[model samples]
Target: MPAARESLLDAAYAALMRRPWSAVRMVDVAVSAGVSRQTLYNEFGSKDGLARALVRREADGYLAGVERALGSAAGPRDRLTATAEWTAGAARENVLVRAMLTGCWTERLPAPPLAPVPSCTAVPAQRRADGPLPTPRDFVRMVRDRAVTVLAGPGASPADTAELLRTCELVVRLALSCVAAPPGEGGMAELVRAVLPRHLV
Candidate 1:
């Protein structure tokens, strides 16, 4: 996370937008980043590692936006609406997001839906070899936590958790589809806005 290393990752992500990950050779990224090939290797280890990092970075940014939008809201309904709008806008605006959607680096396997917690359990301290920590299931857990936060109002109960889960699943799915499909076709924000309030209120 040094400034220089972050600059390199930014360059790599920018390059990936113009070309598929397979075509984004290390030499090209190194040159674009104004860093040496050895440096790239030392930083990310491999192309797959770099690509995964890029994906994780994007995920982190989007989730942060959702958290911010929710925080600014005065109520559950507004928070849900803000979250939907924030997600749609982020999907439409992110070039790296679009590239990851269209590229083959992770094609065979669809990106897992966003979650509130890390996808994987943390490796025990004894299992570490002094590298970056693995991405956790926190993303999914994030989605869950936001829903719970919104639902934690007067008269709220555990019984409503199922509905909140359903709403989050639909919102995330719609945003994913929007990023992957033709522009404006996904209608993710509108879909969420229309569906969430009916269940919440």
Candidate 2:
């Protein structure tokens, strides 16, 4: 089901690049994916549904990159630094990621098809209970939560968890700031280092 949904999303994304989101028809997406229109509708429910899924998938990819950065580094500080660098670099290169980080959509790229609504109001009860769907803001929070856990390590006390949460929140905000307006050269890493305690490093 995921693969099929991805195929549909890839088709929609391709269509979006060629023209405006308003112009990209569901029929065109279905044809591009070699699936029926009903199948597309069944998978996503509507154009808005498809758009949300696409954004979620993109967020998932970005988070996966962060996870990889975390694994590659030697320690907590190094991991946070590497992830920040990676986030800034990736956001610079990818328009979708840039939009997610900065909430600024490009003229060429499709804006999220859904209307603005509070997260709690927009998401269904079942989905909210199961896990909140990955909106861009939710993605940031998700990464922060994961980072807190990683920084805390195993058998963490409440104090350690609280401290790690604060550290991760700071790191994520700094990383996002870099994404919004890049600090050239080694500036991002330096900023991250400045904020972190020596003991954490």
Candidate 3:
């Protein structure tokens, strides 16, 4: 992208973090970015469109982190442990993520006359001008696939490895939903202990 476009995105992101999305006006983003409203519209279409772009940017950041976590030389268990720690840590520290948890800007977006509960799950990767929690399936898939590749190492059959990965996905999803505590050293170890035994056999 052009330098101006990049500046606009950065400014928009900064604005979104400081206040609720409803409070963000396109003009404000333009002013902060040192661009005109017309330029903002040309690049981002509309506020809703800008929201989607923001979501995509954040998602890219997250996927990159996942890849980095998996790329380390650690064993499958350690890799997975580190991935979980980073994920939860990111979620906790991310301003946008905190907005979702605190319900800070729930009504900023246009809603349908009759709509489902405003769970973060409904936000499309491209449609989300706002960042929400990672989907359970997505979170599970990343963890499971990386675990399979690293843990299986050499000589493991692909079929068995796939089975292990799928099993791990299910276990991880349940742990994410049901486990009360945040994932940490002990929590991550417990999650691995629960899934590893079943998949190892």
lDDT of each: 0.60, 0.75, 0.60
lDDT tens readout by residue for model 3, 66-94: 67776764555566655655555555666
User: How many residue-pair clashes does candidate 2 contain?
Assistant: 0
Model 3 residue 79 lDDT score: 63
At residue 61, candidate 1 shows an lDDT of 77
Cα miss at 23, model 2 (Å)?
Answer: 1.8
Superposing all C-alpha atoms, what RMSD in Å does each candidate have to the true structure? 6.4, 4.6, 6.6
Q: Quote the lDDT for 72 in model 3.
A: 69
Question: Which of the two candidates, 1 or 2, achieves a greater lDDT against the reference?
Answer: 2
lDDT of 2 by residue, 1-201 (tens): 356777998998788778877788999999999999988877766776676666666667788998988888788878898888888888887777778777787776656533342333233421322233345576678888888767777898898788777888788888888876888787877888888877786
TM-score of 3: 0.68
Compare the candidates by lDDT and give the number of the best one. Answer: 2
- The 10-residue segment with the lowest total lDDT in model 2: 121-130
Distance from true location, Cα of 13 in model 3, Å: 2.1
Worst ten in a row by lDDT for model 3 = 110-119
Task: Compute each candidate's TM-score over C-alphas.
Answer: 0.66, 0.77, 0.68
Report residue 46 deviation for candidate 1 (angstroms). 1.7
Off by over 4 Å in 2: 105-132, 135-137
